[model samples]
Target: MKSLQDYTTVIRPDNNGIFAAYIPLLSGCHAWGQTPDEARAELIYVFEMIQEEYKEEGRSLPEDVELVIANAS
Candidate 1:
């Protein structure tokens, strides 16, 4: 698993004014923030939680999940 401090993060504004933050490495594990700083910080915590889940289940986590910035709708 990539460290939270080392992995690439993408930040985007969402419909509700909160920002969504995602890791370039993990799929389905993300965080939301009202500000950019919170978004980044939240991602770190989300990453750790995902890591713990993976470790406990003895399963591999999906990586390289790309974030789509545009809404298809």
Candidate 2:
């Protein structure tokens, strides 16, 4: 998979204690969670979805594809 670019993830709390996971790289694919853990979990799915989309679409995975860890706190 040739990565076109890398993306950043921003996680923030919501009104209901759920976090909004944002992929700075992608315009969409945000997920909500009742907790930071939940948000993180959702992010996994979001990330996977994007990869699958590319695979199913017969597209190559971006070179930037990597596990988001530095952004984690």
Candidate 3:
């Protein structure tokens, strides 16, 4: 019942001009695309795939954690 938006995704542009995305909550889950939107789409697919795997394995899905950023200086 968890939507893709429920999870936090970190998207960044790689040096190769490709966009990369990953969910910190889910280990070993990642995706890459030509653009940010594409990267996000791929990440959604990855999320769904991992969720299904967890369900099949009778494992509980990880809960989302709040992320906060602060300046060091």
Which number leads on lDDT? 3
Q: Pick out the ten consecutive residues of candidate 2 with the lowest summed lDDT.
A: 1-10
Which ten residues in a row are the worst by lDDT in model 3? Answer: 1-10
lDDT of 2 by residue, 1-73 (tens): 4221255567898887678987765645688898877887887787778777878999865443455567656
Alpha-carbon TM-score of each model against the true structure: 0.68, 0.64, 0.86
User: What overall lDDT goes with each candidate model?
Assistant: 0.80, 0.70, 0.89
Kindly report which residue stretches of model 2 are placed more than 4 angstroms away from their true locations once superposed.
Answer: 1-6, 61-73
Colliding residue pairs in candidate 1? none
lDDT of 1 by residue, 1-73 (tens): 6577555688899999999999766776699999999998888888889889898999866545444678789
Which candidate leads the pack in TM-score? 3
Question: What does candidate 3's lDDT look like per residue over 1-73, in tens digits?
Answer: 6777888889999999999999888897899999999999999898899989988998978789997869999
Off by over 4 Å in 3: 70-73
Error of 2 at 8 (Å): 1.7
Query: What's the TM for model 3?
Result: 0.86
